[model samples]
Target: MADGGAPTEGRGSVAAAERGATAIADRVVAKIAARAAREALDGVPEGGAPPRATVTVHHDVARVRVSLELDYPSDIGGQCGAVRHRVAERVEALAGMDVPEVAVQVERLHSVHSRRAAQGRIR
Candidate 1:
C-alpha cells in the first residue's frame, strides 16, 4: 500500500525493503583496505611502492588479499599484523563489511642500501 501499491510485507521485511538494494562494491572495500594497509606501513623506514589488494565479498563478509613490498631487516610479522588489523578495521568502518580474513602476500623485499641504490641516490 505504500509508494503506489507496492505491498509492504511484515515490519522486518518492510524495513529491509526500505533500505533498498544497498551494496558496497568489492573494489571499494579493496581500495579502503589498501589505503589502510599503506597507512599502517608508513612508519617503516624503507617502505617501497604501494601495495596491491584483491578483495572478494559475499553478503556482509569480505576476504582480502594484499601483496606488499616490505623492507628487509624489519619486523615482518609485526608489519603484517599491523596491515591485517588496519585493513580489517578500515573495511568494516568504511565499507560496513565484516572482514573475516586478510591474507598478506609479501611480494618483494628491499634492503635500505638497495632501496637507495634502486632510486639512484647512492653516494
Candidate 2:
C-alpha cells in the first residue's frame, strides 16, 4: 500500500478484470425514473399523487413503467412524451444503463369541473 493507502502499481496489483463490477439496484433506478418524471412534469397536480415508477434492469438495460396523475384540460400526450424522454435520458446518464422502453400510465386526471360537481357547486 502507498502512503495514501492506495494500491501501488506493479506491487502485486490485480488486473481490472479481477475486480468485480458495480451494480445499481433496481429500486434506485426506479427512484431516478420517478424523479425524472416529476421534473418533466414540473410537479404533481393539486389533489393528485406524485409519479411512481417501476424499473427492470437486465444486462445494463433498463425497462421502466411510470404511473402518475395529472390535471385535466392539459396536453396528455405531450406530457407523457416528455416524461418518457426525461426518464430515459436521466436513467442512462445517472445509472449508466440503456433505457429501451418507458411505459407511462396515466392513473387519474383531476378536473375542476368534477370537483365542483362533487362539492355541489355546479348544476
Candidate 3:
C-alpha cells in the first residue's frame, strides 16, 4: 500500500509542476508580445495618441494574434506588411520560441489632425 501511494504522490507532483511551467510560459509570451508591438511601432509617429493595440495568445504554443489601431503613411499596405514581419521576428528572437503564425488585424486608422485636436491643440 505504501509503494502504490508513493507513485500517486509523484504523479500529482508532476502534474502540478507542469501547470506551473505552463503559467510561466504564458507570462513570458505576453511580455514578448508586448515588446514586439512596441518594437514594430518604433520609428512610426504616434501623433500624440495613446496606444490602441491588443495581443492575444492562443492555446497553441506557437501562435499569437495582434490587433492594432494606429497611424500610418498614406500608402499603408506595405507599411502594414512590415509591421507584421517586424513583430513576428522580434517576438521569435526575444522569446526564443517558434512563432508559426502571427495574425494582424487593423482596427482603425488614426489621424494626426484628430489627435492634435483631442490633445486640445489648435493647428
Candidate 4:
C-alpha cells in the first residue's frame, strides 16, 4: 500500500515529459516551416512576407504535420520535395525526432506577369 504511490508519481512524470516533447515538436515544426519557406522563395520579391503555415504535432512517436500556403510556379514538385527535405532535416536536428512525412500544399501560383496584370501595369 505504501509503495503504490511511487508508481503513480512515475506515471505523472512520464506524462509531463511527453507534454514537454510535444511542445518541443511544435516549435521545431514552426522553425522548419519558416526556414523552408525562406529557402524556397529565396531571391523573390515577396519572399519576405510572413509565411502562412500551420503546424500540428502528434504523439511523441509520430511525425509532425506542416501545411503551407504559398504561391508557387508550375513544375513545383522538385521545389516542394526540396522544401520537405530541408524542413525535415531541421526539425530532426533541433528536436531529435524522426519526421516520417512532410505534406506540402500549394495554395496559389503567382507570377510576375500576373502581378503586373493585376496591378494594371500590363493588359
Candidate 5:
C-alpha cells in the first residue's frame, strides 16, 4: 500500500502504459504555429495584423490554419511556403505532434503606395 492506501508494488514502479500521457492543448499548438509564422516572415507589413493560427489535433496529428497580412510587391508564394514550413516544423518540435497540413490564408495586404495615396501624401 502506498499513500492513501493505494496499492503499489513498489515506489516508482508504475508501468509505462499506466503512467498515462502528456496532452498538449490545441490553443498552445496554435500559438506555436502563429509565432513560427512570424519568425518565417521578413517583417510584418506596416498597419497589418500579425499572424494568427488555429489548429485541430487528433491522435497526435495537427491540422493548422494560419491567417496573416503581408506587404504588397512581395513573392507571395514564397512567403506562404516559408510560413507553412515554419509552422509545421515548430508545431511538431514543440508539441510533439505530426503536422500534415498547414493552410495559409492571406487575410489582407498592406501597400505603402496605397497608404500614402489614401493619406494624400502621394502626389
Candidate 6:
C-alpha cells in the first residue's frame, strides 16, 4: 500500500508546486528601463530624477523607447549606446524579461555655458 502525497523533489513536484505563474506589469518594466537609462549618464548631471521611458511588453518580450536630455557636446553615439545596453541589461536582470530593442531619443540638450548664464541671472 502507498499514500497519496506530493513528492519532495523532482520535476513533477516542482511543477506541481508552481500552481500559477507570475505576471509582470508594463509600468514596472518602464520604471526599470528609465532607471537603467539614467545610469548611462556617465558624468553628466542627471538633475533630480530619471528620464521618462515608454515600454511595451508582449509575450515576454519588451520593446522600450527612452527619452533623455543629455549634456551638449558630449559623445552622443556613445551615450545612446550605453543607454541601450544598460536598459536591456536592467530589464533582463530585474524584470526577468527579454528586451529586443531599446530606442533612445535625445529630446533636449543642456549646455554648461547656458546653465551658468541662467544661474548668473538668478543672483
Per lDDT, the best of the predicted structures is 2
**TM-score of candidate 3 on Cα atoms, chains taken together:** 0.55
Tell me which of candidates 2 and 6 scores higher on lDDT.
2
Superposed Cα deviation of residue 109, candidate 1 (Å)? 0.5
Can you tell me which runs of candidate 6 are displaced by over 4 Å? Answer: 1-18, 43-49
Clashing pairs in 5: none
Q: TM per model?
A: 0.76, 0.84, 0.55, 0.59, 0.85, 0.79
Return the candidate ranking by TM-score, descending: 5, 2, 6, 1, 4, 3
Output the TM-score of candidate 5: 0.85
lDDT of 4 at 106: 62
Please, what are the lDDT tens digits per residue for candidate 5 over residues 1-123? 567776666676787678899998999999999999999999889888899999999999999999999998789999999999999999989899999999999999898789878889645
Clashes of each: 0, 0, 0, 0, 0, 0
Per residue, candidate 3 scores C-alpha lDDT tens digits across 1-123 of 357554455543555556564333655665566556656664445643322333445554457666666674454666557666776787667665567776766667878777777889644
Q: How many backbone clashes does candidate 5 have?
A: 0
Local distance difference test, each candidate = 0.86, 0.94, 0.59, 0.59, 0.93, 0.85
Segments of candidate 4 deviating more than 4 angstroms: 1-28, 43-49, 59-62, 67-74, 118-123
lDDT of 4 by residue, 1-123 (tens): 247654454543555556553356466567666676557654334532444445666653335444444444545777667777877777677666677777776655557666666779644
lDDT of 1 by residue, 9-46 (tens): 77335665567787888888888988998998955345
Off by over 4 Å in 1: 1-14, 43-47, 116-123
Off by over 4 Å in 5: 1-12, 119-123
Task: Output the better candidate (2/3) by lDDT.
Answer: 2
Cα-lDDT of candidate 6? 0.85
